[model samples]
Target: MKWRVESSNMKQLAAVLVCLLAACLADKPQPCTSPPLLTGAFTVSTQNEELWQYAQFIYDALGQKIRMKDLGTYDNQSFTHDVLLLFREGVMYEINDLNRTCKKLPLKADFHPLAIPKDAVLLGQVVIGSSSGPGQGLLVNTWTGDIGGTYMMTVTEFGCIPVTTVQHTNKFGWIMTSFFNNIIGITDPSKLNPPDFCPDAMTEDVTREPADFWSLFFNK
Candidate 1:
């Protein structure tokens, strides 16, 4: 009985040690010097020189991860983007230099601040996953919803109209986790507006006025 108990305890100790190691290895991402997530009424900085002012709920203290509702804006015109995102889950913190919103939908991804135009956006984020499962691999259930998601927004101006692309995937590739994928796209060219919605609120017009606004906020 004594030997059996000792063996079980040893196994538990080993498991605990392994978990701690992984937790150390895989961390969460964050941003540095970001304006505390704004709510109600907030202003943000951006490099694009189009989007200038913005706001967030600014309601409660959040965790390493923040949802769209808390840090997203799904306007009748523009797609939603993050108020901010951590490079990972806990390590590098990304500054919201873009001050952008989502792409009207989710784009499966692993990290945040998707594409910082400049390396000077030195700040980064740490992305962490669950350490509870067997160490089969990383991003296994990414496609199957076994694990949650990491989101990002990519915008391309195809002309007067802008094409917004969103691709979301698990932290680990599908080979590691389940088979789950959430990659979607949306484009608002001042043409398509849902019936009964405000027209101006929905279009992404990056004209000189808005562009200038973004420049002042981000460069400053």
Candidate 2:
């Protein structure tokens, strides 16, 4: 009986030691706070002088992923771009960048600015030798979605937009996260005014002016 009791106590001691060892191993040191997440109004701009444009973007912080709304205007345009993108959502509307004439389009695409394309090639971390900003980062190159051309982006935990970027094509110009301002939400562009063109259907002005048949007849 004495021997059996000793064995039981030894087994209990062994179990306790195992648990303590596991706890010590799992309790690794961690950073004090999580990395900063973009939540509010921010400005995005391009580095190329001739391709300069300003975009005012607002972020909705109430969801798992912050929702984004972008309002863009060109350098010399009197009015904002007719099209404003709501991230993965379709075209909210198309307005004439020059005259403010507006139309709507059914064009929808699954374009998340932070989404990693299926074919994206992870090219390792950013190095000081590269023209990218300081600090090591995850470098990824992709040729999908609205990128319109191949793009290389350096992602960091600090912000959704690339810390550094290079777009091989001008279709979607390079964007830099310039400013941050906390805001509740962004107003929907569609709600601002009634569409000038077709509100219910997307339209394209394919009409051509009447050809000069008289001139052709005289020349031929």
Q: Which structure among the candidates has the greatest TM-score?
A: 2
Candidate 2 Cα misplacement greater than 4 A, ranges? 1-49, 59-79, 86-91, 95-102, 108-110, 122-148, 158-161, 170-198, 205-220
Candidate 2 has an lDDT of 0.41
Off by over 4 Å in 1: 28-188, 191-220
- Tens-place lDDT per residue, model 2, 108-133, is 33333333455555555333345566
lDDT agreement with native, every candidate: 0.28, 0.41
User: In terms of lDDT, which candidate is strongest?
Assistant: 2
Cα-based lDDT at residue 2, candidate 2: 100
Give the lowest summed-lDDT range of ten residues in model 1.
156-165
Global Cα RMSD, each model: 19.1, 12.5
Backbone clash count for every predicted candidate, in the order shown: 68, 1
